[model samples]
Target: MTGIATSCATSPTQPSGVAIEAEKIRQELAALTALYEERNNQFFSHLHPLLEGSAFFKESVQHDFETFSEIKMNIKITRLEIRKEDVWTSVYWEGTWKVISDASPLLQSGQALFIFSAESPPRLMETRGESPFGVFQKAGTPAADVPISTRE
Candidate 1:
């Protein structure tokens, strides 16, 4: 009788490159969102490095801090498009914002687009659409009442 030996090697599974990148972006956004909710001094420091020095963004953040005693944001990334260039990635996200002030908390939901830089850790380049920070600004303003002309 003859004896034969066989050996096999197996390695643990790892996430794909896209999955890793998506998770990284998600984490970065989540951390930034938490800072917004905290409304602490550290929020600006954390935000400055991530943003592409948009004065409007800074002002919006300041306005939000002044407008709400507490802000809670729940962000869900709906789509992520990645590229290799000056424009790294674009994230389409929907967020539910709950703002608390002297009055009862106001809840609103909206979607926005975030453009990131091509750096290793992507920095926010631009933001479009409805943003969580400006919910109260829009809410507080009264809407214009314009009449439409009808053709007989």
Candidate 2:
């Protein structure tokens, strides 16, 4: 982060640091897809040097390592927005993942917000996701720590 040179917002036509950072995240996702397929640890470098993904992220990775002999993932960025006043970025994305041993491939998608400090890596602040099976959100419980209503 410290190494990132500050760029002047000279023209609307020119890309800003936010754009460049988002692109870097895109590259990381692509690399992660390849790494997941290969079950390689080298993908670590591609992630934010310090990542604060949701509990689901940790669980999903652990589940993959424990349950799957082969795994594949694909992340697509549908849209991204970055705020200049703050170090936060919001991304809307979709993804598909499969457990090769399972009977069918699994598809999942989500929207996430990230916080990036000047010298530190970006952190995944929160996310809301849905899969073929259910929905997930990275957030606190409702008032009084009650579960959200499942009723329609």
Candidate 3:
């Protein structure tokens, strides 16, 4: 019994599968956000791997690059939950974007939900709510009103 107890104490507790997946997704998101702030060519390469060639993602990112001369995003994962085959994370983000033609930077902050597939090295499947990715179009459609569906 003492030997059993000692072995139990010495053995490290393994994290649950969900916890491990969540951490991987969290790290991926952190890297993605850092790349977004950098706004370099490497951001595109890093982004496509995380998103798995999402057309909507490509369009939104392209728009941001064309419209903004400078952009900065600070993101915090507020909550992580698993729903069916997807892992959904709620993110609180603050951002500043300077339009290429504008003199002042636009500052915004909001919460968004990011859904990722449950596969190993999970891919971002969709984004809802106020997207950290630039969802606001030059047409003046509000971010809240922008449809969340992936149009590809």
Candidate 4:
């Protein structure tokens, strides 16, 4: 028997460098979450200018939002529900806004949605699943992976 037998097998070995990518993503997401919790208005307002630039602001959103109490009475997040995925999240929020604050306490309450990616340094904020006309969407269920159930 001058023949040789071959065994087909593979070896499992870890990569040389430890992967901190997941940790990094988590940290970034956490930071954004904290920012939303602490300085939500500032954080959100910054987005309009950064991504859309000055044009979208002056031509599109100008005279579109309200300001009161020395605060941009535009989009206010009342509640937030985070739906996390492998490398992204869907943020659903309840918001109250003053589109046109008249003599009376005219305030409209609604919802908002935001999709967050795991890319480095993050990406521009989006409101794809938000209402076109309504200032904000209902925080309870603003279209997310998880069912944003609410009570009566």
Quick one: best TM-score, which candidate?
Answer: 3
Better of 1 and 3 by TM-score: 3
Question: Which scores better on TM-score, 1 or 2?
Answer: 1
Encode model 4's per-residue lDDT on 19-136: one tens digit a residue: 3444443455455444443424344443422333433222223223233211122333333333342232333333333323353333333344443333454433444444222232
Predicted structure with the largest lDDT when compared to the true one: 3
Clashes of each: 0, 0, 0, 6
**How do the residues 57-94 of candidate 3 rate in per-residue lDDT, one tens digit apiece?**
66677677777778888889999998777788899999
- Give all candidates' CA lDDT scores: 0.57, 0.44, 0.72, 0.34
RMSD of every candidate to native, in Å, equals 10.1, 10.1, 4.4, 13.1
Quality of model 3 by C-alpha lDDT: 0.72
List of clashing residue pairs for candidate 1: none
Predicted structure 3, TM vs. truth: 0.72
Error of 2 at 15 (Å): 4.8
TM-score to true structure, per model:
0.68, 0.47, 0.72, 0.33
Relative to the unseen true structure, what is the Cα RMSD of model 3?
4.4
Model 1 regions lying over 4 Å from their true place: 1-12, 46-52, 86-102, 138-152
In candidate 4, what residue range of length 10 has the lowest lDDT sum?
Answer: 143-152
Question: What ranking emerges by TM-score with the best candidate at the front?
Answer: 3, 1, 2, 4
Preferred candidate (lDDT higher): 2 or 3: 3
